[model samples]
Target: MTAPQCPVAHEVFDQQYMRDPYGTYASLHEKGPVHRIMTPEGFPAWLVTGFEETRDALADRRLVRSIEYAGEDYRTLPLPAEFSTKTVATEDGAEHMRLRKFMNKSFAIKRVRALRKRVVELTDGYIDAMGESGETDLMTAIALPLPITITGDIMGVPDEDRANFQYWTDSMLGINTEVVREAGATMLGFLKRLIDDKRTNPGDDIFSDWIAWTDDDGKHLDDHELIGLGFMVLLGGYDTTVGMIGGGMLALLNDRPKLERLRANPEQIPDAVEELLRLYGTAHTGVRRFATEDMTIGGVDIKKGDVVLCSMGAADRDPARFENPDEVDLDRPNLTHIAFGQGPHYCPGSELGRMEIAIAIETLLRRLPNLELAAPADSVQWREAYLIRAPKAIPIRY
Candidate 1:
């Protein structure tokens, strides 16, 4: 079947597009729900945009999500063997649901609800450790540490070992080739050691819980699955939340009045979290999906094996999904955007994710009311990336 005409100025994978896709997404969304684009590897794919259609398309299964289509190489950047495993994002159907079911109990809203106080403690302590610095990088001082510690807490790692694990986790996700390998090796080894330790002396952490967790027929994550799942949670947890904190902080700083409002009433931080997520969700462009069957969507025809790309970054900013979408309104009503994505593949750590961001914004505002951007907005450097995007570093003086 012939696909609809493409609307982007350049292929979605093009470096220029990566730098800024807001304009392209606006143009494409106006055309319809979807349009064809070239993948980072230059392969043809459909970029879903219309808010309703994007949600519908993600819910529909004509496009399968599985490792079968994920070939050896990543679509954009070069991927090492460490990332080759078919994660929850890359898996499909029953296997996907099965894995997700196993995780649901642990990642449920109720479980995360119980973690609220703890999330605050983590956020507060990280801030306390900052002592008395006239200026500090929020990402390093708070954003990066909160989620890293949270991930470590979930995995049952010792407090002392967290800094080491956090370092390698970043390394693996980093673009540096050598750093990636070193991180992969280090993380794998540490997880193995941690797993061995858990076997003998399991504690009340996610890793220990998972070790004892089982299904109706006694299904459980095997050792290999354990390693993969361990790496997956850390990778997803640390970077995504860290990016959210960094990006969200920048958003809040740009709207200092809004930041002040949230600070005045800490109880309002939850609404502030929703608004921040809607305004500054982090994700460069998410992964690609291949059609397993013919499907017509958003006035476009998608054939079997046709690739589908969903950009959470673009979808969150789609004006149709949000009222006054670009503007940050703490009181925005019915605020729902696909920052953590939609459908069954929605980020499992979302509740925890929200809490982390909420606490980060609240603590920083309360403790460092004088927080001022140390770097010029135009002068601030942005890291070049395709899978994830965040400030290279944010300088702030408080």
Candidate 2:
């Protein structure tokens, strides 16, 4: 089938859109669920906006995550070879399931639930360091370090090595291409060494488990696959959780009534966490997928090999699927937002992320009864990245 005539491409991920994307998403939804759009990097892709369409596109087997299916014109984030091989995010079908199976146990509900006391301990320690805070950047003081430390803890990275890992991870994800390349190489080398050590000296951590694990058929991930999985875990576990905690906290601090309600009824924090995720959830865009065959999503025709971006941020706030989609209603019955995405590639660490966020928020509300934004809400700066959504910093007073 031939490609359909495209509409004028809207530059939807520009600086202005980064500041606030929901308005643009609402505008796109009003016209249609899918639209031709230009990414910040100047590549054209189809953007799925409506909640139903976004969810359907995520689950559609016709759309695949492997770059091999992408047309020559499709552009993807640049990654070192070590970072690209055998990752669950880049695989499909049986291979994806196999790769994911190795990680499922570590992030299982029981395992995540077991992590609650440790999460609380870490959170309390961070809050205690704030020392009855007068003012501080929450991102630095808690949001950034908490998740990174937890990731290091779970991966069995030595305490002395965490700072280096954190530096490399931040540089690799930053806007500087040169820094990204250099940091990717450094991080790869570090991961290789870490894996080598884990093989010889296993410990009670995920990395050690992965090193020792083999399926019923006596198969296991090779060094390259282990390296890639290690990189993916570091990125996925650290950045997104940081965003969720920081963004969710910022959202709650701005709404005193909701904050107080959560503080008063700590039990409601779990449900309230769902509402925060719906309103301020990160993972602004889903993994980029290439259409494997001609298909239609939300009445918009997609050509084979075309790039498609499903906007979780847009989908979660879609009015057709959610009443008062923009507002935070803790009582909202339909909490089925695709914040963690859907289908085969759904986030494996979702339970861990949810527990981290819930514990972080609950502890903050309980301890810092007067927590509020130190600076004007509108003055807060947002980090401008194509795939993630989070503030640069959240200044707070308690």
Candidate 3:
């Protein structure tokens, strides 16, 4: 005998859904851990709602990420051009190991820790610029610029070209097909030129490292791979960090008591960052995985070729793994939240991202102790997209 189907008719992509996904996810968990539902793009897929199931799915070799291994039926699902970019995100097994190995040194703990002083200096500059404004769009003045600047430096983006890089990156996140195409093309062209420039004048940056990296097998990234990896790294390092900074700040500001608690003892900033990430992760969805064979997750039958969208946000808030999952608890002992995701493809820049966010919060509290949201919490508009769950702007006053 087989388990009966339990298809859910929930809308996974609505703006309202993005606003209160934890609530919706809780309801979905009532139906079951795995729900067959429509994606924001209006395609059907399986969403894993359970904590353990999502963790397992992320590391499951049976759930292949490359569309090359996708079942014929699942192949019809529309994929962003980024999918075909052949970056680390798209590969698995040996090829993934090769790419991960080559990129490891650049993100190693020592390298990321060495960036702390730079991050502090950058944060102070941004705060100084915000000095007399009295009120400012935190997103524009601080959250967005800090990480973008750092990633720009790391990728060797010319200071003069950063404005264009910002435009292309923002456009790449657009839902409009024409805009995405134009932005993608412009970014690719920019990256090609950047890579070419690095060939003759290699600098002490990740781009130069990728150009010069080698392993025992003599493996290295070619120009094409470099372009993909470069764009992916930039997007990963900037967008997600911005989201965490902005979102985490809101989480702190909204709860004055908690804010004051952390303010009183800054030693807990790291743990507070972990709790903030767990409560409201930057991404609601995880990397898409296609089932290579029939499987049952949390007692739901998933067929071969079916696309599984693991909801990391949903998993993080699962009651089974978290107590008072929706509330931000700085003392939450278990920081096993998969905000940066889990398994082999775990975000390469997570440590750096955490440092950026923690420093951003600490700097704000110290510099502007009276900082408060300039608008009502409910009025802050969130991005109406599935890819990133972040506010459009976080207006603030000190």
- Best-performing candidate as measured by TM-score: 2
Taken over the whole model, the C-alpha lDDT of each candidate is: 0.73, 0.84, 0.81
Q: What lDDT would candidate 2 get against the real structure?
A: 0.84
Q: lDDT by residue for model 3 over 45-64, one digit each (tens)? A: 88887899899988888887
TM-score to native of every candidate shown: 0.87, 0.95, 0.94
Q: How good is model 3 by TM-score?
A: 0.94
**How far does residue 37 in candidate 3 sit from its true spot (Å)?**
1.6
**Predicted structure 1: lDDT:** 0.73
The per-prediction CA RMSD against the true structure, in angstroms, equals: 3.1, 2.2, 2.1
For model 3, how big is the CA root-mean-square deviation? 2.1
User: What tens digits encode model 2's per-residue C-alpha lDDT throughout 207-287?
Assistant: 999888986578988888788788888988888888999999988888889889889999999888888888777888887
Q: Name the lDDT of candidate 3.
A: 0.81
Instruction: Write model 1 residue lDDT over 1-398, tens digit each, in one string.
Output: 44356644254545655565566667666666677765545556777777777777777776676546543332533443334454566677776776677677778888888878888887778777777567778778887778877888878889888888556655655556767767777777888888889989998878787788885769777776677667778877777888889888887787778778777889988888888787677764666777777778777887777778776776777787777666788888887777787777878888888888887888888888788898776565555565666666788888
Question: Could you tell me which 10 consecutive residues in candidate 3 have the lowest summed lDDT?
Answer: 74-83
